[model samples]
Target: MAKKKVSKTIDDINRKIKEGKVVVVTADEMVGIVKKNGAEKAAQEVDVVTTGTFSPMCSSGAFINFGHTKPGIKASRTWLNDVPAYAGLAAVDCYMGATEPREDDPLNGVHPGQFKYGGGHVLHDLIAGKKVELRATSYGTDCYPETQVKKKITLSDLPYAMMLNPRNAYQNYNCAINLTKKTIYTYMGILKPNGGNANYATAGELSPLFNDPYYRTIGLGTRIFLGGAKGHVIAPGTQHNPNAERHENGIPLTPSGTLMVSGDMKEMDPRWVVGVSMLGYGCSLAVGLGIPIPILDAEMAEYTGVSD
Candidate 1:
């Protein structure tokens, strides 16, 4: 059998955007609206659905290229705010992963891996317009002869600052609750022992993938709001499971379709991109993303109506 498709096209959605007629609603708000008005009516009335999520995403980072200094050197080593940045790409180019730790951090000491300062913190500081010390050691080349360089720089000073998150935006995630007697520290926030309190990430009804459920509108190159900046879905994220059990409404019962998103780091706001420190565990970055779904047809409308 041939597959049924959404009648909406990218051009149709663009026209709505141009006219500012694109109807947008949080995932949570759509639930109430869908309940009050049937999916058929709601589909006709609504034009777009916007969803957002803020959670500790470990697979987040940035690739920065600091403009070469006078008497340029091939940077063999680089450090951002005392945290080692991978500078093996090219001279003055480096990638800072979210979980990279501070070398001087008291890992086994008093605070035991409590990252007071790290790559995430540095990125946060950069976004916050704070000056971060940049240090590099290089093997001097005749064409680009310089050995050592030390400078203080901000995000504004860099020629290229791009947020390159490898894996993010899980379609559906799980709520964590510790069954052990002892308290557990996890990426899903601190899990209380004996189910004292359950912690669930994602915006629930306000999550992007939760609203779409299926990969109809949201697919490769779909424009999205990432880190408070415009970004696009590049590919399926790591462990992108599409064949999960689904409810009658098409919403997945398990975690499904993830997204690999990227955007300009400079355009990101500090509010949406933040450094996070898990109490007992290592550090992570809290990333916020929002996607606008156009109501092209009844199917799109029905998809948006699926609630928490």
Candidate 2:
């Protein structure tokens, strides 16, 4: 018996992309397709499988480089809309990380769970074309002699605003089920007491990594849909543990691989990249990410069949 062959290659797909003749389908659409025609024939017919996932990602943030101020202030401490940002980098460069609640939040003091504003909200506001307060303090140097500077700034005002998230779009994550007696609030959202409710954070069939279990089509510099704009896989996300227990279908049983993604914050839409404040869980950004998996061969077609 002869071994089956994969008729197409990555270069072939690139040529099809150039010719605007590449076939594409959503992960959901591919399910029906592969189910009807089977993966072998599906491979012959399809060129790509698209996937999407939207969930709260705590390990998300952006880096903003505000232009040097008059007289050059070496910003030692910075805040965006009153949310503290790490300003230990260059003169006016800072990294605003989500999850840090505002210093002047007056709700959580009385109600322990009323965290309304945070770094995520500030980023959201900035992207929404809202002018946010940018305040910074310097130690007053000879070359950069400015102690304090405050101004209202928009996302466009910054020289560079890079949406560099360290970790996002977790592959196969946990299904939270509380076995205790009482409502519990967590990053996965609220879980009622004693298995009264279950919360899971994933798109299941529409998830990207599930379709390419071995990361064959996904790697460094893979293109993705980030915040409704074009983004790229910069690196394997933090805590990317791909060596996990998987089912017979090659899907992980627990949290597995992740992706570090980046895109231009200025090009992102506020609707797709949202700021969320979870009950008793601080703040996070709900990012919308999508990936297009190339169907390179029959094996990849079988893998893109969405094993779980």
Cα RMSDs of all predictions? 3.2, 1.6
Give the alpha carbon lDDT tens digit for every residue of 30-121 in model 2: 88888898888999889989999988888999999999988899999999988999998999999989888897876445644867888888
Worst 10 residues of 2 by lDDT: 105-114
Q: Could you tell me the lDDT of residue 95 within candidate 2?
A: 95
Per-residue alpha-carbon lDDT of candidate 1 for residues 249-274, written as tens digits (9 for 90 to 100): 88788888788899998888999889
Tell me the lDDT of model 2 at 189.
Answer: 85
Off by over 4 Å in 1: 1-7, 108-112
Candidate 2 error regions (>4 Å):
1-4, 106-108
Pick the lDDT winner.
2
Global lDDT of each model? 0.83, 0.89
lDDT of 1 at 151: 94
